[model samples]
Target: MRSCWRSAVATRSSSISRPRPIGDARWRRAELGAQPDLTAYRLFHGDAEGAPGLAIDRYAEVVVVHADSAAVLERWLPEIREDLRDFASAYVKVHPRRASRLTGQDMQQAAPAAPLWGLGVHDVEAIEGGVRYLVRPDAGLSVGLFLDMRDVRAWLRGNARGLSVLNLFAYTCSFGVSASLGGARRVLNLDLSRAYLEWGKHNYRLNRLTLDERDFVYGDAFDWLGRFARRGERFDLVIVDPPSFSSSPFSVTRDYPRLAEAAARVVAPTGILLAATNHAGTSDERFEAWLQNGLTRAGRHGQLAQRWHEPSADFPLAPGRTHPYLKVRALVLD
Candidate 1:
């Protein structure tokens, strides 16, 4: 009996349980009738073309849809838009289903016939806080907000009280808002796109945060960080969230190392650093190794707090479904 119990315990411990609705169908039915809060409704499963990459986001009454798969592009279009209206207001924003040059032709071929479907292209939404702005995916290369970073934003809000916080690659400055709301006296948001920065400003205004609350700088992250170091400008809290690849001036391969060096300079003694890389090829071990090297070169050793793993709701790892590409890892520095 003792051996059997030990085996059972080990089995349970080894498995990762996913979040699911309770067994009571009535309770689930009740929830289905009501619109869920933002955090609660993180994913929308698509069935058109029977592909897995398509997803829809319901922002209050606004529906933002993305189709990243050729299969989905071919099958679901106007139908998907109508289905989303059940949750959204009246407007539905649709982005092109282009993935790579390889899929560009396919996407165009599978495109919907006319504008009668209420599908139209528009500029992405920008949100601002303190010194940062976030260009959300609603109108840009991808989804505007990285929802997985919700915890990191929460962490900033809790610890950034009265301190100056710096947000690097501040896509939409969601963290800046959280930190501002948390009581941070000043915040700085840095990004490369003027369009995204403008959108971010809108988000800040929507939240009723003031310009004095944050600063938005549009330029290369490395140049800004280096200049910040030279000017003796330091931040009490720094959040680094970078994309894996860039087609424009900033490439992670050519830039992350320099950014790390600049971060070391601007980081205060008691200040905290949050560094993240979302490259699917990058493993937790790789992130740790790179950070260790960066810290060593900076002649400063910081503690690695926790590793945050983000699993996509669109593609959950189930019986046969595979989610081998997406990776999100964060290292907290002290």
Candidate 2:
């Protein structure tokens, strides 16, 4: 009997459990109705929401269950499916683990997440701060949108009026969309991928925002920054948010301090600059220090206006955590 009890305990320990909800859902339900307006938000965030290796995000009536380990997702897929029966569609993706080559393979070969139930679809609409953006489930790597940047978009919506905004390293141009929606005079989105820029244009159309050919720039942001500086081009607001690593010739990899210097050059004399990164291992203080150093390199002094935090209550960080995996600093150039 002791052996049997031990076996049962081991099994329980191996199995994945449901994650806790983020605070009260009453406000979310009231704003979005019974089903969370995934266009805005719904579901769990890993570590933050009590599910360490798993996260479930809702896009309107569709659900996207993202897991750190595919095995954990596979083990609990059935329970997840049944629980999300009311959702119009459901999808899943395995986040690539970069611990080692073998771990990377494990993530790549991890059980494919198909539509467990409901009409399995790839594309969906999600809202951030009242602005609509398109999200594609199971897309290579990113799955379309970075949900954590929700507050950055919110900040832009509130402050982009009559200003010219430059979004450097703009993935799908989410910041540009926010600036446009917030009545920016001109918003330029610069990225390395033409495909992503085209998709960004689709997002503009989805939100009924007008688009000009020049608004979507498909080139290296770093190269363009130099040219913009030489041409005396300046923007009231400049955002520099680069991926942790990139092989692209023009992209900055792990060297965000250098990227920040390039970013500050184009900020208008009395403009705002937002530099952010999601690089793991770098503490919050270190990241902020890098941005500060970058400003100094550009011969510009920056006053910290506000360090942007996640606006969505759903993204909870560990209690009293200072460097919570993501860092965004908003500074005003002097």
Best by TM-score: 2
Off by over 4 Å in 2: 1-38, 99-113, 249-253, 319-322
Candidate 2 lDDT over residue span 138-229, tens digit each? 45456667877877787888889999999888888888888899899999999988888988998899889999989888887778999999
Worst 10 residues of 2 by lDDT: 20-29
* TM-score of each candidate structure, all chains considered together: 0.69, 0.83
Per-residue alpha-carbon lDDT of model 1 for 158-209, expressed as tens digits?
7778988888888766777788878998889888877667666776776678
Error of 1 at 279 (Å): 1.6
Model 2 steric clash total: 1
TM-score for predicted model 2 compared with the true structure: 0.83
Error of 2 at 167 (Å): 0.7
lDDT winner: 2
Residue-level error in angstroms, candidate 2, position 192 = 0.7
Candidate 1 weakest lDDT stretch, 10 residues: 19-28
Query: C-alpha displacement of 54 in model 1, angstroms?
Result: 2.8
